[model samples]
Target: MDVSRTRVLQLIARPDFPEPYERLAGGSVWLAEDVERWITEHQPWKADQEAEEEP
Candidate 1:
C-alpha cells in the first residue's frame, strides 16, 4: 500500500486492471480484493508470504 499516486494511475490505465467500483467526486475506487488479486498476478515476489498469512 506504499505505492505512489503516479504508480496507481499507471496501473489503473492498464486494460487488464479491474474496473472501478465507483466514481466519486474526487476519483475512482476499486475493490481491495480485486486489486490484491491483480497485484499477486503481476508481482509474485511480494506475495511469497501471503499464503501463510491467509486464513
Candidate 2:
C-alpha cells in the first residue's frame, strides 16, 4: 500500500475498511482482492498509480 506501518494500521482501523480474513498469532490477514477493491473504490488515484507501476 506504500504507506507507513502506522498509517496502514490507521487505515485498517477505519469502519469502512474490509473485515480481516483471519487473525493469526502474528497479526490479522486480509484478502488482497478485498483490499484492492476497497482501494479502487475509495482511493482511485492510488489504484491508478498502482496500475501504472505494474509491468
Candidate 3:
C-alpha cells in the first residue's frame, strides 16, 4: 500500500476518471474508495509479498 501523495492527488484530479467515492476539499474532488479498490485489485502481488514477509 505504498503510494506517493502527488500521484494520489493527480488521480483525484483527473476529469475522465470513474471513481466510485469522492470527497470535496478546497474546491477539489478526491477519490478515496476508488483508490482503495485500485490498490486491492492492482496490487495483489504486493499484498502477497507482504504477507509472506510477515510472521
Candidate 4:
C-alpha cells in the first residue's frame, strides 16, 4: 500500500486484475482480501512487498 495512486490505477486497469467489489458514488471499491489474493497469485513483486512489510 506504499504505492502511488497512479500505480494503483495502473493495476486496476490490468485485464487480469480483479474487478471492484462495488461501485460507489464517487468511484469503485474492492475488498482487501480479494486484492491480496490476486496479488499473491499474479504479481511477481508480491513476495518482495511482503518482505518489505516485515519488521
Candidate 5:
C-alpha cells in the first residue's frame, strides 16, 4: 500500500481528522478518538484559534 506524503501530512496536521490505529504506533501519535474528544471539549477554543489566525 502506497500513501502520498502530502496526504499523510494532512492527516497528522488536522485536529478533527481520524487516523488509523497502526499509524498511532511507531512514534506516530494522535488517536482518532482523542481528536474527536478534543474537538468536542474545546470547540470554542479551537474556533477562537482559527479566528485569531484569520485576517
Candidate 6:
C-alpha cells in the first residue's frame, strides 16, 4: 500500500478492488478495515512495510 497516489488511482480503478463505500465531494471513501484486508490478502509486499516499521 506504500505506493504513489497515481498507483492508488490505478489500483482502485481495477475491477477486483473494492468499490468505494461512499463518494464525497472531496473523494471516494473506502472502509479502513476493507482496504487493510485487501492489502494483506493481495499485496503481500505490505508485510515488508510492516517489518520495517516495527521497533
Q: Quote each prediction's TM-score.
A: 0.75, 0.92, 0.34, 0.77, 0.29, 0.75
Q: What is the lDDT of residue 44 in candidate 2?
A: 98
Best candidate, TM-score: 2
- Candidate 1 lDDT by residue in tens digits, 1-55: 3779899889899999999999999899899899888878987666766766668
Clash totals for all candidate models: 0, 0, 0, 0, 0, 0
Q: What order do candidates take by TM-score, descending?
A: 2, 4, 6, 1, 3, 5
* Each model's Cα RMSD: 2.7, 1.0, 4.4, 1.8, 9.7, 2.0
Best by lDDT: 2
Better of 2 and 5 by TM-score: 2
Over 4 Å off in model 3, which ranges?
Answer: 10-20, 26-34, 50-55
Which ten-residue region of model 4 has the weakest summed lDDT? 42-51
Please report, in order, the local distance difference test score of every candidate based on alpha carbons.
Answer: 0.84, 0.94, 0.61, 0.88, 0.62, 0.84
Question: Compared with the true structure, what per-residue lDDT tens digits does model 2 show for residues 1-55?
Answer: 3689999899998999999999999999999999999999999999999999999
Off by over 4 Å in 4: 51-55
Model 3 gets an lDDT of 0.61
Q: Per-residue lDDT tens digits of candidate 6, residues 6-52? A: 99889998887888999999999999888877877888698668758
- Which is the better candidate, 2 or 6, if ranked by TM-score? 2
lDDT of 4 by residue, 1-55 (tens): 5899999899999998899999999999999888888888898598678869889
For residue 24, what is the lDDT in candidate 6?
100
Positional deviation of 40 in candidate 6, in angstroms? 1.0
Could you tell me the C-alpha RMSD of candidate 1 in Å? 2.7
| CA RMSD (A), model 4 | 1.8
